[model samples]
Target chain A: MMKRIGTYLLQSKYAISVTVLIFVVLGASLATSSFLTGDNLITVLRQTSVLFILSSGLTAVVLTGGIDLSINNSAALVGCIVAQLLLLGVSIPVVILAGILVGVVIGIFNGLLVGILKLPPFVATYGTNMVVLGISTIVMQGKVIYDLPRNFTPIGVGYVGILPIPVIIAIVLTGVLYFVLQKTTLGRNIYMLGSNAYAAKYSASRSVLDTVVAYVICGVTAAIGGIVLTARLNAADANMGNSYGLQIVAAVVMGGTSLLGGEGGIFGTVIGALVLTIIMNVINVIGVSSYLQSMAVGIVIILMVWLDIFTRSKREKLSRV
Target chain B: MTTKSLGKRIGSLPPAVWMIAVMLVFYGANTKNYFTASNFISILIQAAPLFVVACGQTIIVLMQGTDLSLGASLNMMTVVWVVLMQKSLPLSVALPLAMGTSVLAGYLNGLIVAKMKLPPFIATLGMQNILNSVALVASNGSSVYHEHAIYKIIAKSSFLGVPYILWITIGCFFLTMVLLKFTRFGARVISMGGNPESLKVAGYSPDLATIQAFTYTGFMTAVAGFLLACRVESGNPIVGNGFEFNSVAAVLLGGTSMREGRGGVGGTVFGVLLIQILKNGLVMMNVSSIYQTAIIGIVVLFAIMLDAYIKRRQEE
Candidate 1:
C-alpha cells in the first residue's frame, strides 16, 4: 500500500510539490504563533492570488517552450499609466478597459517579435522589459502614487462572503485556464508544440497562431494581476512588480510544469503558488531580514528546476527499461 | 591601390562604427573643443568600468549564454570588499576574498547552467537574486563608504595623458580579445555555441567550455566592480543597476548574432563604445536621465532588428 502511494505521487509530478507544501504548512504552524491564524492565512492567500493570476498566462507561454519576462514590467507600466488617469478622476471601468487594451497591445508586440520575427524569447522579452521599465519610470517620474480611490480596491482586497476577492478572481482565472489547456484544441496545440516543435509543425498548422495566443494570454493576465496588486496596496510604483519578476515563474515551475515547456497544468500551479506563499509568510512572521526573502526565492527556483530535471531523467530511464 | 583598399576597409565597417562617427561629429560640433584631451579623458573615465564589464560579457554572448547575475554579483563583490575593509581587514585579505566570492557565485551559475542543463537566463537570474540579497544583507541594507589611499590614487593617476582607469579598460579589452581569438579554449567556446555537435564529435565537453566562460565573466565583472568602487570611493548595493541588460544589448548591437558565434570581441569593443558615447553625449547635452533609458532601449531594439535583417539577407 505504501509503495502504491509512492507510485501514485511519482506518476503525477504534483506529488513532490504537495508534499513540500504540507511540510512547510506544518513547520510554519509549529514554529510561529503569528502563522496559522485565520487572519494571517487569508492575507497570505490574498497575495498568492496575484501569483495565480500571472502564472496562469505564463504557464501557457512556458508550455509553448517560450517565456514572457516582460509580463510583470509591462503590467506595471500600464498600472502606472492607469493610476495617473485615475488620479485625473477617470471612471474605474474605463480605467480597467484601458489597462487591458494596453496589455493586448504589448502582448501582440511580444507575439509578433518572438513568433514571427524569430528572435530568441530572452532577447525579445528582455528588450521589451527594459523598454517597459524605462517608460514606467518616465511616466511616474520616480514618484509613488498613493491613495487609490476607495471603491477601486474591491477586485484586490474586497471580500466576497468572507473570502478575499483576489482569491475568487484567481480561482475563476485558473478554472478557465485549466479548461482551455486540458479540453480545448488550442490547449493541445500548445502541449504538442512544446513537447516537440518540429514534429508539432508537421501535425499542427496553427502552431504560430497558438504561440501568439499564449503570449497574449500571458500579457493580459499580467495586466490584471498588476491592476489587482495596485488596488490592494492602494499605490502605484514603477518597481511594484519588480519582485514578481521570477516568483510567478517559480510558482509555475514548482507546481510541476517543466520549464522546458509542455507537460503541465494550471491546477498544479495553484499548489505551487500556495507553497511559495506559505514559505514567504513564514519568513515574514519569523522576521529574519526581509532581504533574505529574495535569497529564499532564489534557492527555491534552483532547487525546483533541479528537481524537475532529476525526475524527468528518472522517468525517461524507467521508460527505456 | 593603397588608397582604394583603405576606402574599402572603411566602407566595410559595421553600422555601429558609422553611427559612432555621426555622433562624434554631432557632439564635436555642439560641445566646444570636444576632441581635446580633457574631454576625451572624461568620456574614458565614464566608459572605463562598463567597457571592462562588456569585455567579459562579449564572451558569454558569443556562446549564446547570458549571465543575468553579472551586475548583481559585481554589486556583491563591491559590497563584500567595502564591508570587509570597514571591519579593519587588510586590503590583501579583503580583496582576494571579495574576488573569490564573485568567482564562487559564477562557478555556481556555471554548474547549474552547464551540468543541470537549466536555461542560462533562469540559472543566472536565480544567482542574480541571491547575489543581490547577499549584498544587501552584508551591507546591512545601506551603502558602505570606505576610503583608502589606493582608491584615491587610482582615481587621480594618469599615464601619458590618459587616466589609469582607461588604460586598465584597454588592457582588459585586449586580454579578452586574446582569450577569444588565439586560444583553443576560445575556439571551443565559440564552437560549443554554434555547433556543439562538432565539439562533441571532436571529443571536447561543451559543458566545460560553458563553465570556463561563466567563470571568466565573473572574474572580469569583479574587476570592473573594483574599478567602479575606486572611482566613487564607496559601495552601493544598487550601484550596478541596468548593467545586466545593457551588456546584452551592447553585445547584440556590436553585430553579434544571438547565436552561432557570428561576432566576437572585435565588434563588441565598438558596440560598448557606441553605447558609452551615446550615454555620455546625452548627459553632456543635458538630456533628462529619465528619457535616456527609453532612448537607449529604443536604440537597442532597432539596432538588433537591423542586424537580424542584415544577417537574414546575407544568408539568402
Candidate 2:
C-alpha cells in the first residue's frame, strides 16, 4: 500500500509542482533579500504572464497529441502587423482584434494541413513558422516599432492597485480557459479526440475538425500573448518572440502536460509558468550570463521530461500488474 | 495487359512527381535564363550543401526521428574545422576532427533518445541548445573569415564545369542511395521502423537503428557545413541558423512519409531539386523572398497531403 501511494504521488503532476514550488521558495529566499517581497513576486508574475497565456493554448493542442510551432512566429507576424497598423494610426481595439484574427488565419492553415490533410504537426507548423517569420521580417525590414498609444500599453505593463494588468489578464484568461477545457462539451470532445482520434471519430460525439478548431484556439491565445509582449516592451520587433517557442514548450512540459496529448490542466500550466519565471529571475539574481541560461534551462527541461516519463511508466506498470 | 502495365508505370512514379513537375514548370516559366546550361549548373552548385544535408535528414525522418541539432552541429563543425586548421593542422586532420565532433554530438543525441529513453524531439532540442552555446564558446563568438587556398577553391573551382562541392554532393548522394538499397544495416533500419516491437522480438534493437540513422545524419550535416565553409571562404557564427528547416522541408517535399519505414534517397534528391528550383525560380521572377518562402510552405503542405492520400489509398 505504501509503494502504491508512492507511485501515485510520483505519477501526479502536482508532485512536480510541489517540487518546483519548493525550489522557487529556496531560490527566491536565497538569491535576493527582496525576492519574497510583494513587488518582486508581482514582477515575476508579470514577466510570466505572456508565457502563461501562450502555453494555455499550447496545452490544449498538446493534449490532442499535436503541437503548434507557429505561435512564436505567429507572435512575430502579429506583432509586425499590429506595429504596422499602430504606426498607421490604428485604434487599440482594432489592432488587438486584427492581431487575433491574423492568428486565426494562420491557425486555420495549420489546422487544414494537420487535421484535414493529415500532415505531421511538427512539419506543418515548422513550414508555417518559417513563412510567417519571413513575412514578419519583410514587414518590419528588421526595424523596431515604438510609439504605442497610451491605452494599449496598459494591457501589458499597467497596474490595478498592487497587481499588474498582465497578471490579472493571465488569471482571468486561465479561469475562462479552465472552464472551457474542463467543463464544456467541446472541451470533453477535445480530450476524447486527443486520447484516441479514431475512437472519438466513431463515438458520434466528436469531430476531428472541431478538435482542429481547438488547436486554432491555441493559436489565438499565442497571438494575444504577442500583443501583450509588444505592449510591455512599448515596441514591436520582427523577432520579438523568437525564443519563446522552446520556452513555452518547456513550461508546458514542466506543468505536466504530456506532449503525447490528452492529459494535464491549465492550472498546472500557470504554476509551470510561475516556476519558469522564478527560475529566470533567480538566474538573473545570481548574475549568470544570459548565454548560460539556455544551457541551464535545457538541463532542467531534460530532467523534468525524465521525471514525467518515469512517473508515467511507473503508473502504467502499476495499472497492468 | 499493356494498359494495366502502363497504369502501373504511372502509379510507380511516386506522388513526388507532382512536386517535380511543378518545379520544372516554374523553373521554365520564371525566366529565359532558368533552364540554360550555365544557370542549371549554378543552381546545382548552389543546392549542393542543402541536398547533402537533406539526404541525411531524409534517412532519419524515414526512421520517424528528427535531428533539431543539425543546424547547430553544422555551425559548430565549420567553426571547429576553421579554428583547428588555423593552428596549422592539415586538412586531413582538421576535417576528421570536425567530422568526429559532429558524430559524437549525433551519438550523444542518439544515446539520449535510445539509452535514456527521452523523446527524440526533446533530446535533439536539448542538443541544439547545448551545441549553440558550444559553438559560441569555441570561437568566442568570432568569425573565421580566412582559410587555406584549397578550402576557398573547393567552393570556387569546377571539374568538368561543375563545382567540386557539387561533385562531392553527388558522390554522397550515390553512396547514400547504394547503402540504403543494398546494405544489411539499411534493411535493418527499415525493419526496425516498420515495427519496432517485432524487430525487438527478432533480436534487433530499434535503438541501434536509430543511432545509425542519427550518426549518418550528423556526418552528412558536417559535410554540408564543410561545403558552406568552402563557399564562403569563412565561417560565420550565424551561417547555419535555419538550415534544419530547409533540409526537413526538402525531405518532406521529396515524398518521405513523416511516419517511419518509408521514403528513399531518390525522393529526397527530387525534393531537394524541387526546393532549390523553387527558390531560384522565385528569385528570377522577382518575387519577394517572404512570399517565396510562404509559397514553399504551401507547396510542401500540398505535397505531404497528396503523399498521405496516396499512401492511404494504397493501404486500402
Off by over 4 Å in 1: A1-8, A197-205, B1-13, B25-35
Q: What is the interface RMSD of each candidate, in Å?
A: 1.3, 2.4
Expressed as tens digits, the lDDT of each residue in A70-181 for candidate 2 is 8888887888898789888888889899999998888888877777667778777877887787778778876788878888888889989988888888988899889988
Q: What level of docking quality does candidate 1 show?
A: medium
Clashes of 1: 0
lDDT accuracy of residue B174 in candidate 2: 91
Tens digits of per-residue lDDT, candidate 1, A167-192, equal 99998999899899989988888887
Which candidate tops TM-score? 1
Each prediction's DockQ against the real complex? 0.65, 0.52
lDDT for model 2, please: 0.79
> What does DockQ come to for candidate 1?
0.65
